[model samples]
Target: MGNTESVVVQKRLTRFRPEERPVIEGVFDRLQGGAGGPSGAPGKTPAGKTLTLEMLQSSMGSLAPDSMVRRIYQCMCRIDPGMAAPAASGKTSTPTASGVGREQLVIFLADTMRGTAEERAPLVLAMSQHGAGAAAVVTCEQVAEFLQDLISAVVQILVHRGRLQAWKPEKMGDGSLGVKLLAEQMCSELKPSDQGACDVSCLEDWIFRVSQVSLYLEMLVAEGLNVSLSSRLAPTLLPPCRETPWKELRCLLDLPVLMFLAPQLPDSYNAPWRLVFSTQLHGESFTRVVTGLTNCGPTLLLIKDTKGHVFGGFASHAWEVKPQFQGDSRCFLFTVFPRLRVYTATGYNQHFMYLNHSQQTMPNGLGMGGQHGYFGLWLDSEFGRGHSRARPKCTTYGSPQLSGEEDFTLDSMEVWAVGKPPEPEEGEEGQGKRSVLHMDPEVQAIMEMTGKTLHSQGFREPEEDQE
Candidate 1:
């Protein structure tokens, strides 16, 4: 980095906090042969103010693979052509430039972490090019491959950092398939040309349309590169888990699906995911499913059809076993396999959620969206048969048929209670009967800190307190 570039980089560094600026600069210095090796091992340093691809890969640690690191370097070179080591003249070339400078590194970090969709779109395009030489457009296959690598990096980061929140990978379904499906689903958002090639405009449009693209990229950069960011800049990617027997659990959802769906839930940023029901554990009975689902708060119901389609719905409120429609517009229909897309209420009708059983006159089943016999998702009281029917689309949610078949056979299902359970009703038992001091120790700690009277501690019976 020359004096001119140094001044420019420092000016841009002001965008970060005073304390954080040094960390970003430290990465630049380390890559430019400052003091120690990538892993802090003492070694002879190279002489240059530039970051070679080797240095970038070494600095990225063992978590990130060569593919991701190469993309990062290519994106950096695209950001500043001057930083790229001189290439042979007149030959088609990969942006496998020898190195990039301090300015390019700083800008890459800034755009990935803080810039808007437009600013990051070019980086995505550059990365998606892979090893294509002088290719002006990227095919859909290329983009999907890029996203697969990107998502793979996110998963590795989560696993390597022990950030799974007690989720055991072995207890779940094939996560690699989930990763591939998610990548394809993300790629579906792009409007490619007749040749199935996506230009920069198509990519920019995708980045603007799908908010998840930016989020995944931001997570990859922040986590894969081990960058420290403020809480506001980098919110928790996965929700914490309430104490549950995670080891014994078998789930239909893998980490990739969880990563895709967790951020979509409203107001659940810090909420813990609680397992409410699973056919595998609780048995294949509708009564058991209902028993597990009722009054368990907002839940995500995932179902895999016999034909291998994974889809479900988000019930915004506690499911009451009644014939009448129950739930507001917050409820929605979503698909996980084949493609991942969410359909919210259109307000065309109030047919959001319905659940009933053991009734002779009324239809006894669980359904969400659309009308009777033409529901967007309907699970029969028979326990194994369900249908996701839509003539054109569901009146309420405007969603297409969710299951693989109009009437599909159930393969497996699970319900996850997201966010905190609704407050206990008056005179309710079990968890509801517990007092605030018992339920939340944070409240008790605050009272003690403020020198408040511990009346509950003194007056409450020992058994009640313990409960």
Candidate 2:
């Protein structure tokens, strides 16, 4: 989920589909609808007419762009074809073996929709509670919209509920309340193909894999947008965060995206990495921070905008303060909070996203340089409002067709490094042990950026390696 490599690609990654789908038309028919008549209020359906799956599906399918269609297809793919009684009666050809996921989905829906009176599915009741007017005879579009909103609301509730109930907060050795970030836990273990149990961690990882967060980031870069993290964040979220200090921010960095796109790292350089440098992008520390970066290790950059939104990039090359682009095909950009997106480095165009443009010239120009577009990260703390990007239009070397945020606000950025683990001393046979761990208060603050904590409650001395 960190700036790691992927074992699978878009083409190779497989999506499972059930051989059949439960005819859910009846489910909609079961939805309570208000009666209509000549004397009834206008814009109502006739007394017998009601919302149905066909109407909803048709309406959804009519929307532009094939992704929606594909999403519907994948959802339908989760339906169990064998659930159709006609197949058992031989009215249909032999049914293919049903997928557990598909079958489970069907049963799950059935359970959710179970009714006490047998007059309507329990889901109908649930929908009504969520504002699906019991007033019958809604339009197909209205039904479709209601269902979409319902799903969004449900997912949001489910995510935060999971966080509140199970994930306990622990005060770290530094006395800072820390909930282990799914991102840190997943750095080494997550994979796109993993179909493990649907635990919270797994659910989080799966969202990173399947969601179009990366595509959105790429579009932003392709479009040359430099805006506040909030503007960039709203679209890529799983369940949008409307309130401040969103607890889910910690998991923003947890995504199943590989940073470097081409030219894999040499075996020796592929060792695990730990956090090193982290600071606000606007401080005077900015110059020393940029100069301090070495090409000896991989670098991960995380940026937070004034709005409390966070995003970043992973560079395969050791970071350097230079006018020219450095590093391999491995560099990529990403966002953690409000959902994950990791945009990989590319060489499609002559332009490149580079770092380091000044000496005593000081923190004025864009430090994070990008391609074909004026897009890049910039911060002059004294300026009050930093620039993330504006009207970004140039396509990246990747030339992705997807669109991105054209303008955004900037607040701060964090840069971390990935390098070989410290070698064992002669007598010490394995990895070194450290009492205090993975990230610091600044690190935790970045993780908790969306939470109520404005700053990390603790700060340990810098590591010797960093010094």
Candidate 3:
């Protein structure tokens, strides 16, 4: 009879709620005076009992700030049907689904227990994989709404934490705000596409605006402008811009001025176009000059000083070239985008004889003295020799001759600067002559014939001049 009653009691205990069953067993064991007596054992507390309320209140009080926040997040997650039941296990007395294991429920509950706002701040802004998954499952409108709320909450937190500072928008050239408010407005006004289109166009636009703001801040820093904001915000204000096709093209086309320096070119002659500047050449000087010209195209040349490195301007055949004297002497000017390759020659005979005998010895033997001579016309070779040697007596050629019938005729050639111009002599009439032009009249004429100005000195439009 005792064994049968025990079996019945066990069966009855099994029927209790999973959460309640543990407490019931404790009470039953205590009542039967098994192991611990009723007074000694922590027995089951009834729903309306003082101990039950105390236990509930204690559990609630023990929850961390993060737990509270996670509880709210779990509530948010319940939007998905699969996530709903697991989230409801905290307060419900009903039996959980077989798929919702006790361990999983405990993990969810533990996460929710850390519900304080402070604890949740970092997680809220963190781009979580789960968040991304939720975003993928949800509509873009929902995502945008969530992001907006998240950003607002973050801003509020920052403010409350005393990190908020007034940041003024950058000013444009016209003294207007440069923050691209229009883009922001568009993002706010446009409805996100619902077709799961990964058009991060809005984000891209925002990033670009931020980059511009960063640039403005850098300029301000350079100008010694005072800014109250922390320097850390500089990076935040300017994130990397997304590379669109147009941006990539712009990167390729925006050639730097340093490309014009002569030293940067390849060692051997490889450029498709050749530049023939009218200067006296002596011995093998022309070889050095040509090599220097070629070299300029490849190297990133800089003029160094104590201040810092300064970029030398790029050389191109397209710039203006005017011939000062015409006598089998024509100054070639114009720029060509050359496909260059390095020239390789084996043997000393080939290297020396090639440059000196064949190349330097112009057809008429009217070669400028070789690279070694005093009257050498090649500027690049001499410059490479450095100032340590006795300065050559050769009168350095001034700018290309601007006069003569062939003057200003344009031709397809590549131009690069090999060396810095000699410092002006004291009391010289033209103390500072920095600009050099290699004008090709042929190109100018063709451009003029086509009613386009090959080179315009001022801002006058070619069409206006034609009219």
The model with the greatest TM-score is 1
Native-to-model Cα distance after best TM-score fit, residue 273 in candidate 2, in Å? 5.3
Q: If ranked by lDDT, best first, what sequence of candidates would result?
A: 1, 2, 3
lDDT of 2 at 120: 21
**Whole-model Cα lDDT of every candidate shown, in order:** 0.76, 0.33, 0.25
- Model 1 weakest 10-residue run by lDDT: 81-90
TM-score, predicted candidate 3 vs. hidden true structure: 0.18
Per-residue alpha-carbon lDDT of model 2 for 85-142, expressed as tens digits?
A: 1111123221122211323233323322221122122222222221212222223232
Q: Find the candidate with the highest lDDT and give its number.
A: 1
**Model 3, 385-445: lDDT tens per residue?**
2110113221221212111111112111112232222233567533233122223557656
Superposed by TM-score, candidate 1 places the C-alpha of residue 461 at a distance from the truth, in angstroms, of 21
All candidates: TM-score: 0.83, 0.36, 0.18
* Candidate 2 global CA lDDT score: 0.33
> How well does model 3 score by local distance difference test?
0.25
> Which regions of candidate 2 deviate over 4 angstroms?
1-273, 280-284, 335-350, 357-366, 369-373, 379-386, 390-392, 397-410, 419-467
